[model samples]
Target: MKHIFKFLGIATLACLTWSCADIDKDEVGDESKLPNAVYIEGADVNPVTKLTVDAAGGKSSFTARAANKLGSNVTLKFAINEKALEKYNELNGTHYKLLPAKYYSLSAENLTISANNISNGSIDVNVKPLDNELDASTKYAIPVSIASAEGGSLLNSSVTKIFAIDRVLYTSSLRQNGFYLKTTFNPPYTNLQEWTLSYAIKLDQNKDNQAVLSPDFYSRVTADGGLQMKVGETDDPKAFAKTKLQPGKWYYIAWVYNRQHVKCYINGTLDTEFDVPKVETFTKLNMSWGAFVGYVREIRLYDKALSAFQVMDNLYIETPENPNLLFYAPLDKNTGIKDVSKNHHAIKVYTAGSDDATEYNQSLITWQDEKFPE
Candidate 1:
């Protein structure tokens, strides 16, 4: 009798396992389970985002549900305008294509089946020679679309973000005459956020042999001495050290000072800070990444103070390959400058040849200033 009972238990367990396996397979076939609610009615498709450089890369992802209440798998299609495609496909194209700029169309083969456009999916993408006007201030439309194969119905369509590429500085080097931050008097403003400087700084090193790059550098070298803050002596020029600023590493220099406190960030991390002066007035702030020459790409300025989180997110595009710590590896030994501005503006500088140290304006965010005036 004991042997018979063991056999019956084994049989029951087998039945349960088979039943569960069968249900799992059915879920993939049913599209009703997918959640999406969107419909594309017109021929005009909204662009997802605009890119600045001739070679650009980015990712786009969103959720969608089927049209009818019935769950049925739908197909998605992402395509650029024919003109954009033809331009990229040109022979011996003078333009170069780079990652995050490569075009691609992905489909799950009826992956979504649900009531309305109800499903979740995402795709990573890139584009080259993005059919944008040569002007940096002008905005261009990048058309994107989604659709189902069965009924051939189109879904979501909307413009993404505007893109701005800074005016290009075709020269070989920037002027060495560094700009001073006048923080003490007018103090740098949030409007200074997008401005970037890429030249190397010559340190007048101290006993420690370490050259210091301070947060107040923006205000210290400025016409006004330093900005007003709550603590510490703003006049302490030694607030910085004589540390080596290495080449091939990317650093973000900001004119970051306000009524609360004065600070500077390196690669999205806080490297220096100073107390707010009691007088509440200072200037002559100075800052730099590399001195006299190096490389700078994607310089931008914003009108507001960016929180740490916001700055990190914006800087992520160029954060890969430890770029913030070191330079990006390129096909040639020369370093590659990734995107500087992520949201609406950016600067990208790539070295075409070796030997000449690339220099840019440390004071001007826009390319309108003379980098290396003839």
Candidate 2:
């Protein structure tokens, strides 16, 4: 299971104003003509990392930024070549594909465009693509041009000179039992209002079980004891009640808990919500899919609690061939799919050693906050 985790808010807006005044200038005299006069001095699009989905259900992201400077807010449209996406969908009429979970620095070859009468501009960017087994081959490039609203003619174009994505590889051997990920800090500070956990579970009373990304223990306000495993416990909220589970079968589970609220997603369905108190701290966090059938794959943990929509976005049934089991093997980490330990740390991971006892991974990921520490 891969446990995972941005910026650009009010401060960025203020900075935009100070650096680019033309963006806020008055529009053309006529509203209809406003688009015609609209010359995007600067535009960019970036995919949110970790959350980006690809063909194999990995992470991929694209980020775009544009400044109209034309006075009125005209839709700045972005078009991807038809071949750019896989597993495409049509929700209503708009079409989008699930981005791969890896990092990819798009290059000029990966993109195609035609533009009109504007020229003399440049594009600056930093990108990381999904696969880069080699250096010097290049993973990203900037495509900048001056043209009409419809990319018709190109006055000038420039490609990024040197693009590199910081490569990060998370180990897969850490998923086995006694394996826990812990950050700096103790209990009471591990409670985070924006943390989300999602994974698959299959418990086997007969054999060694596998649990994807189960929270060993959680304090649920609705639970009789105020704490319980995410499911299969009577004390848990009705949503988490473990009624009957079959062995050798996979059941999807998602839990979003925080100071602000709490909810659960079972088998891809937003089943229930309960008014739960914020949990500051507790210990002995252990999770296995269904009553000890501790088998798991593709586990993810987010620093911020996710909304229903975001939780749905996090679901990806596909996985890499011969995927790693323990540590995180991010397709790309340079873009921003990184550790959530900005402040606190509570994930402690242990692995089965040669002696059969558990061996610590040595690397301790600090909690972005200190609500719960091991």
Candidate lDDT (C-alpha), each: 0.33, 0.34
The TM-score between candidate 2 and the true structure equals 0.38
What does candidate 1's lDDT look like per residue over 39-157, in tens digits?
Answer: 43222242223343333433343333344454445555444344442343242121212222233333332344333444445433333443333322222233333433453344333
Q: Which stretches in model 2 have alpha-carbon errors above 4 Å?
A: 1-147, 150-191, 205-237, 241-246, 267-269, 282-284, 288-291, 298-301, 316-374
Error of 2 at 63 (Å): 20
Model 1: lDDT of residue 374: 14
Q: What is the C-alpha RMSD, rounded to one decimal, of candidate 2? A: 15.4
Candidate 2 lDDT at 54 equals: 24
For candidate 1, give the lDDT of residue 264: 56
Model 2, 1-374: lDDT tens per residue?
Answer: 00100122433464566664443453212233222232223221222122222223222223222221333222223323223222122221112332222433332222222233223233223233444343311222222222223332221111111121223322221223444333323443355555666665434333322333334444222212122234324343454434344554545566677774567776656766664545434333343312232344334555556556455543432122211111222212121222232322344444533232464654432112100000
TM per prediction: 0.36, 0.38
